[model samples]
Target: MTQLTTIVISNVKAADETDLCISIQNMRLLRILSIKVTNEEETLQMDALSSPPPNLQKLLLTRKLEKVPQWFCSLQSLTYLYLHWSRLEEDLLPHIAALPHLGRLKLTNAYVGKQLRFGTGFLKLTVLWICNFPQLDEIIIEKEVMPNLKSLWIDSCMELKIVPMGIEYLQNLQQLDLTSASRELKNRIRNVDILKVQHIPKRYIWK
Candidate 1:
C-alpha cells in the first residue's frame, strides 16, 4: 500500500475513520485521494489523518467539515481540490490560497459566510469555481492575487448582487460564467459592471 498513488473511498462511515487514516498514512506515494460520505450523519474525523500523503496532487471530499484541517497547509503539491457540503462558517479562501501549486479549486455548499476574499498567494492558480453559496453576498479579489487565473465560475449564489470586487485586476482572466444568479446581479454586470469584465474573452450569464 506504500506504493499506492490513488485511493477513492465511497460511502465513508464514521466508524471507518481510524482505519482510513492508518491506510492513508501508509500510502506515501499517494497523489489522488477522494472520500465521499453519503450519509449526512456520518463524520469522517479528517484530523485523524495526522500524516497525510506528502505528494498528494488532487483531493476531493464530499462531506460536512466544521472547519478546514490544519494539515491542509502541508499539501505543497496539491493542484486540484473539490469540497462539497463542508458548511464551514469561516472564510476558506485565506487558508487554501497559501497553496503554492494549486491550479484548480471547486467549492459547492462549502461555506456559510457573507463574503469570500482572495488576497495574495495563489501564484499558480488558473481556475476557480464557487457554487451553492446561499449566504455569500460578495467576493473580493485583491489586485495581485490569482495573477494567472484564466477561468472563473460563480453559480447558485443568489445573494451576490455585484461583480467581484477588483475582478478588473485579473488581466489574464479569459472566461467568466454566472449561472442562477440574481436578476439584479445580471443586470449590474450587463449595465454597471460591464467594464470590470470587458477584458475577459468569454462571458456567460444566466438567471
Candidate 2:
C-alpha cells in the first residue's frame, strides 16, 4: 500500500488466484482499478496490466478479453483506459505510448482499428473512442504524432472502407464521430483538413 488510492476487484475476482495477481503487485498508490474477471475460463492473462499503473490513474476492463496482456508495456502512471469487448490489438500502441500522462482512450470492440501504428506516438492522447470495430480501415488523425489528440469516435466500423488516410495530420483535433457509417461509407468520405471539426456525428443525415 504505497498510499493506495482505490481498488475494487470483484466481478467475483479470481484470476485463478495467481498469487492474487502478485498481491495487487504490491499496490503502489494504485489510483483506481476496477476489474471484474467474469467466468474466467482461463484466457485472462494481464501479465499484470503490462506492469505500469503503479499509480494507475483510472483503468476499467470489463468484459470479453482473450489476449493483449504483456503488462501493457510498462504503464507509466496510466491516465485512463476503458476496454469493453476486449480482444485487443494494434500491438497496444507501444503500451499506450509509454503513458506520458495518457489522457483518455476507450475501445469498445478493441482493435485500434488498424492504422496509426505509431511506434512511439500518442504524445499523451487526449480522447479516442473506437466502437464496434467491424475491422476499422480509416479514421487516421495524426498531427506529427498525436500531439494531444482532441477527440475521435468511429462507431460501428463494419469493415470501414475510407477515412484513415493520414487524417489531416491532426493538430489538436477537436471532435469527429463517423456515427456508425453505412451509407455507402458516407459516399466515399475523404475530405481531410479538419482541425476542430465538430460535426460528422448525426450520421448519414440523408447523405
Count of steric clashes across candidates, in order: 0, 10
Clashing pairs in 1: none
Candidate 1 residue spans exceeding 4 A from truth:
none
The regions of model 2 sitting more than 4 angstroms off are 1-18, 25-54, 57-77, 82-102, 110-125, 133-149, 155-180, 184-207
- Please write out the lDDT profile of model 1 over residues 39-149, one tens digit for every residue: 877765677888789899999998787678768888899999999888887677778888989999999999998999897788899999999999999899999999999
Which ten contiguous residues of candidate 1 have the minimum total lDDT?
A: 38-47
lDDT score for residue 196 of model 2:
26
Q: Whole-model Cα lDDT per candidate?
A: 0.89, 0.64
- Model 1 Cα RMSD, 1 decimal: 1.2
Tens-place lDDT digits, model 2, residues 1-207: 656788776553445546556656777667888776655443445554335546778888766556666676566778888887665654566656766887888878766445545545778787887777766665554447777677777777767766565555665566666776765556565333232232333223221
